[model samples]
Structures are given as C-alpha cells and as structure tokens.
Target chain A: MKRKIEFATIVEAVKKCCIEGTKVLPQDVYLKLEEAEKNETNSLAKDFLRQCILNADIARNEAMPICQDTGFAVYFIEIGQDVEIIGGTLTEAINEGTRQGYKEGYLRKSIVTDPLFERKNTRDNTPAVIHYDLIAGDKLKITFAPKGGGSENMSGVKMLKPSDGRAGVVDFVVNTVVNASGNPCPPTIVGVGIGGTFEKCAFLAKKALLRKVGEKNPNPLYAELEEEILNKINQSQVGPQGLGGDTTALAVHIEYYPCHIASMPLAVNLNCHAARHYEVEL
Target chain B: METKIIKLTTPLTADKVQSLKAGDRVAISGVIYTGRDAAHKRLVTALDENRELPCNLQDAIIYFVGPCPAKPNTPIGSAGPTTSGRMDAYSPRLIRDCQLRGMIGKGNRSQAVVDAMTQYGCVYFAATGGAGALIAKSIKKAEIIAYEDLGAEAIYRLEVEDFPAVVAIDSSGKSLYK
Candidate 1:
C-alpha cells in the first residue's frame, strides 16, 4: 500500500512556504547584499545598498514583504512515486495555499489574467508556475522562489558553436549584463546554464540561481570558469544602479548538463538584489 | 548621509523644482498621495468623463506605487515605487488638468511626459524601487482616501516624514541620467 499524505497538511505547508519565502530574504542573497554594501564605491549606490539591507532586516522583523514586487510565486516539486496525495488534487491544494498566503501575508497580487489585452488582476495570486518530477524516494521536496519581473525580463539564452567554448560564454554573459545595466537592479546574481538544449539551458540557468552564494561548482573546470567569469563581471564597473564602481555582481553560478556533440547551448538568468527563495522537504 | 525633510505644495514653481537634482538625498514630508497603473487609468477615465477627482491634484506630488496590503496595527505594508514608465500615457493629462507639479517613481520616462513636465513646471523624483521596508519607515501614516475596492492599487492619502527620494528629472528639463 502507498503511503498517504494529508491534503490539509500539504496545503498548510505550501502557505507557510509562500509567506515565509516572501518575508525572509534567502541566506545566499543576504550574504551577497552584505558583500555588495561593503564593496560599493559610489556614494549614492552605497546608500542604496544600505537601504536594501535595512529593508531586508525590517521585512524579516515585521513579517512584511521585502519588496513591493512580491513576484510570481513559483515552485519546483519532486514527488515520490510510492506516496499518494489524499483528499484533493495537488494543483488545487497549491493554488488554495497561494491564495491564502497572498491574502494573509499582505503580499502584492502581481498576476494578471491576460498578457497582451484585457489585462486584469487575478486578485488572489493563484496559479503558480509549478514543475514536478517523479523521484525514487518517498519524500516530497518543494522549492519556492518569488521571481521579480525586472531581472526576469533581462534573462537570455543562446546556442553557440562548440568551437566558441568558454570565451563565447563569457562574452555573452558580460554583454547581457552591460546591456541590462541598472534595469535589473545591479549587484546581481548571475546564473549561467551550460551544455544543454535550448529549453534545458534556460531551466538550468534558473536552477543555478537557487545555489548558495560563494559556493563553487563541483566540477573543477567549471568551478575555475565561474571564478573567471566573476572577475570579468566585477570589472564591468556597472556597480549598483549602474553608477560606475567595483562589484557589479556578487557571484556567478554555473550549472551544466550533458548535451549532444553538435550543439553548445547557454543561458543567463539575472536575479536582483532582493532574491527571495526557500526550500522544504515533507 | 544626513537626512533632510522638505514639504511643498503642488503646482510648484520652477525655482523650487530646480533647486533639487538627482543624487541629492531628500526626505519628502507632509501630504502625498499614491497611484499606479490601475489608478492612472481611472484618473484618466474620470478626466474624460468630466467627473471630479478623488483628491485635489493641484500642487500635489503623485507617487507611482501600488503598495502591499496593510497588516493589523501597521500604518502601511511594503510601500515602494513602481516603474514610472507604465504611467507615462496618463501623467500628461493629470499635469494639465489637475495642476499637478511633481511625480515620484523610478526608471525612464517618455519624451512627451518630459516635455509636459517642462511645460507645466513639474518635476520627477525617484525613490529606490525595492527599498520598501526602509521607505515604509519614513511614512508616518497612511489612509485610503479613494478607490477602496482597488485593493493595493487604490489611492492612498499618506502623511509622511522625511520620505527619501532623488530628483530624476528637474524643472528645467535636465535629466539626471544624461
């Protein structure tokens, strides 16, 4: 017989996850912000960074959102094949939890029904972007990330020739950040996806952003490349708010997957200073 | 990093607006109202209908924000500035009709809006967009004066003290970025 997980328990967990995720800025992001504050050279940018840090502290203390753009709630779930959800559907529980959390937590309902025309606020902030995978174990793992639109707008993916190699990846990432100066709120966290298909590369780029700050890649070559890219990005002098200074980026995280011989796919996902995310296992 | 509070009425003169510039840290005191994309649409609609506005716009600085909902015992929730470009289409009308003199937000604005600010003696200020908690500290009180049904997007009459901001566009048509 399959192990049963109560729907109400899952709903409660989802609500808690969403609320806590918005209120608390992730540890990695906090470390990055602290480093950015220490390294910022421009007076105005320094003040801005200081305010960002204060904002995080206050948000956590008061249980308020760190930013007005509470963002679109997204979750990646890994479910066990041996476990079964009882009482309700998985999607329904998650949506219900999202609605409750947005209302109770006082977060902004940022979702609109239509993209182009007749754009209407959904009010409850329901219908989260959820990704699920079947896993071997009986445990259910969920990661929540509140992705702001500014950085999301700046994300890009490219397919380069195998001959392009590391140099091509560096150029593309730097160019993307330079072009996006001040738009995504600099002193950004860069997530690079390498060695995947077009869609897979984009997915990996976002996944890489979930990694802890200052953490090195497991692969020795990739780890070295991450440091190289970090040095080049900090040299951009875009600084905080593009005012020109040292420390344009806090860290560069690279996630790679095995790909076909003919193609070299890459992607870059930028996360703003207020990177809010959390994970829970049930 | 000292803070200073300045309070001024709307339909402000060129001299007052020109005195401020980008990167000059300021704390805006006194009465300011909030509005964003949805409220902008309604304000424009009211103007088109020849109906009365929810609040007096003359000599008022309209903040482009749709703050998070207020929790119990709290004056306001995470109240931060929204992107200003989203309100470009409706701002010119507000400036002309309501004698509005100042706007506050972040990021770029359109040429027409810039021209309107110059012609109308209005100025644009930028508050740090993501610094909601810190910004909320400067807001002493917040009351919903209009459009209560719009939820967070409603017009709020805020009594603030030393609300920090930087002058993005000056009265004489000088842009900080340029």
Candidate 2:
C-alpha cells in the first residue's frame, strides 16, 4: 500500500528546516570549529576562530541567520518508494517553503532574476535548487544547505588528461584554494569531486560538502587523500580570513565516480566557516 | 607585528587617513553610508549628470555592505562587508569626484583603486567577513537614504559606534592584499 503524504506536510517541514538551517550551525561544524580553535597556533587566527564560534552561538540563540547572505536554498531530498504525494508537486512545495522561510527569518534575498544585462532582485528568494532521489523505505528525508556566493563563486572545475593521475588532482585543488585566498572566508571546508562527466563531477563536489565535518571518507585511500590535502592546505598558511596562519581548511572531503577512460575531471567546492545546514526526516 | 588601534570619527580628514597604516585595528564611530553595486552605479550616474550626491562625500567612509532588514527593537540585522572587488570600478571615480576618504569591505582592491586611494588620500578597511551578527551590534541606526527600490541594495545612512575593522590599505599606496 502506498503511504499518502500531504503536500502541506512537506512544506511545513521544509519551512522549519530552512529557517533552522540558516539560524543554527550544525553540531559537526560547531565541533570542528572548536577543535580548530584549540589546535590553532597563531594568536590572531585563534582569536578570529573564537569570534566565529561566539558569532555562531549568538546567531543560534537569537534565532538569526549565521551570515547576512542567506544564500541560495539548495535541497537534497530522498523520497521513499512506498510514498505518494497528494496535494501538489514536490518542487512547488519546496519553493513555497523557501519563500516563507527566507522572508519570515529576515534573511537577505541574494538571488538575481537574470544573470546578465538587466539583473533584478527576485524579492522572496524563490525557485530553490532541489535534487531528488528515490529510495526503498516509506519515509522522506530532506536536507537544506544554504550556499553563500562568497564560497560558491570560489568553486572551480578542471579537466585533465587521464594520465595526469593523483598528482594532477592535488595540484588543481590546492591552486584553486590558493587563488581564492581570503575571498571565500578562510579556514574553509573543501569538497572535491574526481572522475565522472563534467557536470556530474561538479555535482559530486557540492554533494561531498553535505558530509559531516571531520568525518572520513569511507574508502581508506580517499580518506588518506583527504588528510593529505587538508595538511597541504593548512601548510599554505592562508590562516583565518587569509591572514596567514596554520589552519586554512578544516577538512577535505572527496567523492569519486568512474569516468570515460580518456578524461579525468576534477571539481572543488568550498564552504566557509559558518557552513550552515540542517536536515529533517518525515 | 605591532598593530595600531585607532579610534576615528566620520568625515575623516586627510591627516587622519594618513595616520593609518596597513594592519592597524580601527574602531570607527559616527555616520557612514552603505552602498553596494546598484547604489554605486546610481551615485556615479548622478555625478556624471552634474547632480548633487544623496549624501555628502567629503571625508566620507562608504561601507560596501547590503544588510538584512531589522527585526523588532534591533537597529539592524546581521551586517557584514561584501567583497571589495565588486566596487572597484566605481570606487576610483567616487574618490576623485566625490572626495570619498575611506571604504570598508573585504578582500583585495584593484590596482586602479589602490592608486586612487593614494592620489586622493583615502584608506581601505576590512571587516570580519562572515561575522555579520557580531558586527551588527556596533550599528545603532540604519535608514535608507536613496534608491529605496533597490531593496537591500539601497543606500543607507548608518550610525555606528566603535565599529571594528582592520586597515587593509593605507594612503601611501601600501596594501595588505599581497
């Protein structure tokens, strides 16, 4: 029997998630910040990390957004095979929730109606980017991640010859962070996607960011690479806010997929220290 | 490295700007105007038409910010600096044509902007980029002064007290960007 779910139920849950997502820092992120603060050596960088931790607390307690640029509302949803929607399309429900959440939460509407020429504000920050997948259970899971342009704009993709190998991927990732410097708000979390087609690689890179901070990749080799990349980034001395210190990145998360034998595609996505996100199970 | 701690009032004089150096910590008090991309274009267009600016620019500090709306009782919501590179094209003109003396934002400025700062006796300050909630505490008042249609991007006159920032570029053309 198909379990019927009302569209309104999804909207309310999504709305709550959107509001809470921007207002509160996830536990994993908070823990990472605290750990980074304790391990940070430079006095100034340590102080900046402390400020960020305190800022997160104030935002959470006040029910205010962690950052002014409330960001593009991106959702990852998993729908159970046994569930059937009753009232409206899933996309519309998510968008309605985004509109109310951004407006009610008093978050900034950063979306422009057009990319070029006559760029105009969308007002309520609608048309959320929603990605969906089907699963076996009878429940629904939704994760809301508000991605700020400061870090989003810094993301990059590079296509290399298959022969370039692991060294090539490392160089590309490090160079992207180096070029970004303090612009993306340093002590960033790096998400890397290797293999796949051009667009798939980019998607994988962003999806990698949804992983819990400091959580190792399931593959031992990938987990080792994550640690190596993290070490290399911290050694760059970009520090907190790129002022030159020991902690340039908190963690490096990588996801890979097999690609055509001829091409090796790599993508890098960065999330700032705030890294606000929340999840809901319905 | 010894960093200077400065307490500066608004409508800063040339001497005040010259006294600042790269890496100094400043707590600024007094009135400042907020303008991002849209408001900046409008200001420059007005100048091209030989029209008066909405706010006086003499020794003025323009904060490159677009803040969220205020909640009940609060003067402003989470407010932080946007990337300074976005305003580079208009900043040199604002400095030369409007006597703008200071700017507050994050990241590096264009070479033209750095040169303009030295030529016009101005300084650039960088606020903590993502600490919007903490920064809002210093802002006591916020009112839209022009381009209200721009919504969050409208020009705002803000009354700030001890607003914290770091001097990223001094009047001598030296910058912290490199």
- Model 2 clash pairs are none
- Give TM per candidate: 0.90, 0.97
- Residue B129, candidate 2: Cα error in Å is 1.1
lDDT score, candidate 2, position B77: 87
Q: Second chain only: TM-score per model?
A: 0.91, 0.97
Q: For model 2, how many clashes?
A: 0
**DockQ of all candidate complexes:** 0.51, 0.69
Which parts of model 1 have CA positions greater than 4 angstroms off?
A: A159-165, A260-263, B1-13, B45-52, B96-99, B146-149, B176-178
Candidate 1 chain B: worst-modelled 10 consecutive residues by lDDT: B3-12
Show where candidate 2 strays beyond 4 Å.
B1-4
lDDT tens per residue, model 1, A70-130 = 8888888889998899999888888888889898888888888888896678899877988
| lDDT by candidate, in order shown | 0.82, 0.88
Residue A87 lDDT in candidate 2: 93
| lDDT by residue for model 2 (B113-149), tens | 9999999899999888788888888999999989888
